[model samples]
Target chain A: MSSFAPPVQRLITELGRLPGIGGRTAQRLAFHLLRASEEDALALAEAIKEVKARIGLCEVCFNLSDGPRCRICSDERRDAGLVCVVEEPSDIIPIERTHEFHGRYHVLGGALSPIDGIDPEDLRIAELYTRVTPPADAPQDEHPTPIREVVLATNPTTTGEATALHIAAHLREQAPQVTVTRLASGLPVGADLEYADELTLGRALSGRRALS
Target chain B: MSSFAPPVQRLITELGRLPGIGGRTAQRLAFHLLRASEEDALALAEAIKEVKARIGLCEVCFNLSDGPRCRICSDERRDAGLVCVVEEPSDIIPIERTHEFHGRYHVLGGALSPIDGIDPEDLRIAELYTRVTPPADAPQDEHPTPIREVVLATNPTTTGEATALHIAAHLREQAPQVTVTRLASGLPVGADLEYADELTLGRALSGRRALS
Candidate 1:
């Protein structure tokens, strides 16, 4: 026999399709929505609709935005000469939380994975090249500063490393003046170095700098 | 500065209110929704709206339903004379899944919790009594069978046990003819006897029935 009403079953099915949510979690969420006031449930619906309707990729950095440019790209105080490249818009959150990078960002949408059939053409690599290149139409005063450094802040995974190296090579050939750097890796803060993997330990040893 | 746009932040805030969902998970869900196709996202939204708009409590059993009577209550084949009382509508699912219960259900909405100020008046106990009692107005052919048994299937938690005891006591005083029973408690099937808790093992020893 059918368990729940059609609407409830449909809601559960839709909710279950999310990345981490499962059948039980979807049911819990659906029930929560049922228990919530109309204003609250409708607000979530409206937010979903509004995000899709209004938000789009920034023209400059391809980060999520409500207009042509994302907030960071539009801000004049941010260093225009520095750019941080990441895999997805979500990655920008942790970097921003660090308060270390004062530059803008480039969202690749995803990292290169040959086994998964993803390649440089699948991402916004051409746009990155264009952004790094000096705009021919704009007057010198309009575009005063050229990007001097591009930080490859992609994940530490194999695909991320490959994508960064590939991008760095292209940038070196096309824009030789720009400097490329990757985030430092070491035993995580509060972690016991005894449990650190061999690859990470090897990288830590080689990249070690003079103690302050 | 705001990490996300207004709509994005609002969606994250709303999603974060769900049980077990943290701020990061909420942001992840919001981003997934943003990336989902319009049809997929709108379908979820519409389902949420439809469940709230159409569904209400079952008049007879207090289970969630689209009309006055729930599906089980409306079905003529179900054993209405045998009622299984439970704490919430969701509790009915596992019982149904077992395929052992062909009887109808009565949802209590919640168990008795004196600390939380829950009492008999707060639940549908009166309605259950009304169901058990022979209706004065119904014709002989229309309402032939009076409720014969009430299975106290509330959760085995403290409040659930108290609610079941309270209901059993009231039923004995008011409708002594009706049989009252509680679900058997013991070591779960496939569980190691050595690992079974003392209380459960003790109950199993005391309530052991003769092997066929």
Candidate 2:
């Protein structure tokens, strides 16, 4: 009704919803798609649908996966006794790229932000304890080996800190024989791990500290 | 192989195919979707498919439309004597928002870019000329009113300027009785009308001048 034909308006609206795409950019993008070949426009659409339908959460580590477990979780080379806990699946990539830590991962799904109502109960913290200290028989496997160390790689943000503390405390109680560590302190405080440079994340992983 | 899971990499490669979304941003957005709620992620996928499936070019004006004729072209109340010609459908939105031009529109689809191999034949120029010189029986019920003026609202870019000039020359030769005018010069040179502030665009519109 605001002058644009409904179809034109709808394309713009959807494009604007994407991150960093503004109204003007969205309009430009919509027009570009309109002007492009039908095959190209349909290609973008198919890509979006294919990614959503085919990809899923890794059963063991909760990372994005196309099958039963993420590539890292399925790999025989990664250390079974070492698992790094982080806030989101995206955080796992930079660490994995470094090739510095040949260990598995545990995606918490999100961090502990009480104000945001994200408590330990909301995250996969209980799952971490369960994975590290399995109840003798997990029904799926004989026994989840007594994990030797769990490096808390959650972002250095406020919520990340709280989640790390909660995990550190819980792991100490549940898996007393296991060591719980936090990624090193040099990460720019309050920044998300996704934005950190490879060198910094690598250093943090290599120089991790034991939780007191 | 390069640190990303195959599906994640595939999704990133596909997302990078969009205009403006690059490799790093594609990776970031792909991961964002991985963590996003299934409904929200699928909504984005559905929106992409829906827009492409439902929208098509308006046969009358060549603008994006849900039906045969564009909404503006189909409207009975529009001033048929006044037709605004623009390089793209997105241009229609700003002019429509002004409320100053009650005229319908003809989207040229693109400008005359000889360097890019886009010529008058590639655009809706012939159709515009035909619109200017109406059908023989067009006004059998009412007094025949030849199109009074064509407001060329193409962007201020080099190609846009050339396109406007080309159309003006054609209209002068084909429809001698019709007056041709380009949207005014106050529009910033080399800038797109889509990004022009409404006030500036409206002013340029109100102060439009006849092309010699």
Candidate 3:
């Protein structure tokens, strides 16, 4: 028989299902909740329920949202003509933290990985194309401000690179007027040159900029 | 304004309150939950609620239990006369895993820490004494099997040492017939002598037994 009671074992099982949590961590967390005040423990439970009940994907950008559209999609202040495409909703936060992108975002849901069975059709790539391209029935002037540029801000991983290239090629054929760009790849700031990986060093050498 | 919606922010805040979880980890967990299926997410929330609602301290030994008495306390086969005293309910798991002790346990709830205002009164030390010492009003034959021995299985920390010493003194005065002992302090089973700390090495030397 298990040392812990049924309920404790159940809680540990559920907590262990989380992405990074292991069995020991789940046990520790369960014990902590048991020791915590009723109000505090219930707060964590209520928060989990509330997030699940209220949060959904944005209709337009596919970013996580509390309503039909995400905050960025609803905001008129952000540049609608410039779209930064990322692999997931979580990717938008870091870019937002920088205050570097004044434009909206397009969450692909996930990157392409053939070995993992994730393909172009599996992602929200078609939805992205539709968002960028105007309808055939609509007049040229009907949509005054068309998407001018697309910044592929997918992760620098192999899958992210493949997904970005696939989308960029499709966008070129679908919307010839739109400009496609990729985020700069080089050694990170504050990094020692000696410790830089061969691939990163090569990218840094090839993409080196001239002194102003 | 917060970058995330109210529910997402609330979840992150609650997760951040957990031990070792920081803001970034909290955010990562919140995002992971958001991405998870509704059933999977609800299971975690329900688990938290169930653990809080169903689990309570064992009435007899003070270990976490789903009922009045914990598993160890309820077991007839275990040695009730031999008690192992620990600081918290969490400590019981490791001892149970070792399978070296067949004795029942007494959870003190916490250790003695004068700086933190924790004293004998704050713990279940008095309850332990009550369990060890039979009532004066009871006849000798009324309680056939009296407590015979107590093993102070508290941590090796300063507070734990003080708590064990205090309990030993009280047990000696109140129930002189019972044998009281503390867990030995020394180098761990699989440790190397070169990396051993001075205090631990000294304890190993002092506690060494004669080679047969």
Candidate 4:
């Protein structure tokens, strides 16, 4: 049998699973939880549960949302025609923080990683194709809502690079009317979007170079 | 109004309350939680609540416990007479991992942080004193348990050092018969026990030096 009680062991195990926490750090966190006031401890617990219960993926953009559409997608002021495509929901934050993009976004869920068996089908590529292309039937209304441009904002990593290329090429064939562009090379050659500083990312947005 | 949806904002606000997590990290974690599988998200949530529900302070030694006494204090094999005094429950893990000590522990809650107004009374110092000194009256049916040496294994920080000094001095007056020794100087002078590597902590445990 182990020296620590079951609750202590459980706390340590759960804490160790977090991104940066190690065995020692987990133990410290476990002890901190042990010492915390009942209300405070339960507050953290309720927060986790509440987040899980209420928060969900945005149907339009695949970012976090409480309802079907995220705040960005639901906003009438947002430019729907100019959709910026990226790999993950977390990527949306750095872009949002920069205040550079007035357009809405489309999260691909993940980049195309053939080595990982994540091909074009694994992402929301089909949805992106539909979002840009003119509707199958002509609109009964006075004017059809046409998508004008799509910025391929996937990360600069190997997978992110390949995904952008695949999306751009596919969009050219599927939706020739829409202008397709890729983010510029201001991103450090091989860094993930998660790690890039805001200034570099903002510059990349402003100085975005075309893939075509 | 802020751009983020209410659920996203709520999660970010709650995450920011953690010890080291800032606004950006909180936002990232919140989004990560949103993307996480319902099972994974609920697992972390239940773990937090379950820990608080099941865990409590060890009355005997002040380490975390599910019941009246912690696993260490309740274990029959552990030498209760040879108690290891530590600044916090986290300190107990390194000592256990070393496998050098086979004794129970008395968690001091925290070291004396005068700037923060944390004194000896703020910790379980009086309780530690009581444990070291047995009651005068002996039970007729049972042989009285003998409480012997106390290992003052507080951290090596300025606050930790001061706490150790205060404990040693108090123990001298309260329980003159008991031997109170501090862990060896192999520990770097100004560091907390949490940062010390296992090998160094192990060496320090074995080479424990007696206080003057």
User: Judged by DockQ, which candidate is best?
Assistant: 3
- CAPRI rating of model 3: high
Query: Would you estimate the TM-scores of all the predictions?
Result: 0.96, 0.83, 0.96, 0.83
Chain A TM-score for candidate 2 is: 0.83
User: Candidate 4 has which clashing residue pairs, if any?
Assistant: none
lDDT of 3 by residue, A26-131 (tens): 8898889999999999999999999999999899889888999888988889899999999988899899998889998999999999999998899999988887
What's the lDDT for residue A178 in model 4? 88
| lDDT per residue (tens digit) for residues A79-155 in model 4 | 88799998987788788888888888999999998889998888998888867774667464412356788999999
Candidate 2 - CAPRI tier?
Answer: acceptable
Q: Of 2 and 3, which scores higher on TM-score?
A: 3
Interface RMSD of each: 1.2, 2.1, 0.9, 1.7
Residue A133, candidate 4: Cα error in Å is 1.6
What TM-score quantifies how close candidate 4 is to the native fold?
0.83
| Candidate 2 clash pair list | none
Model 4, runs deviating above 4 Å: A138-144, A187-212, B1-3, B137-143, B187-212
List, in order, the clash count of every candidate structure: 0, 0, 0, 0
The DockQ scores of all candidates, in the order shown, are 0.67, 0.46, 0.82, 0.58
Residue lDDT tens for model 1, B1-212: 36587878888998898878998899999889888888887787778778878888888888888888888988888998899999888888889989899889899989999899998999989888888875688667645568899999999889999999999999999999999999998889998998999988998898899989
lDDT (Cα, tens digit) per residue for candidate 2, span B92-121: 888887789998788898899989999888
The segments of candidate 3 whose C-alpha lies over 4 angstroms from its true place after superposition are A138-144, B137-144
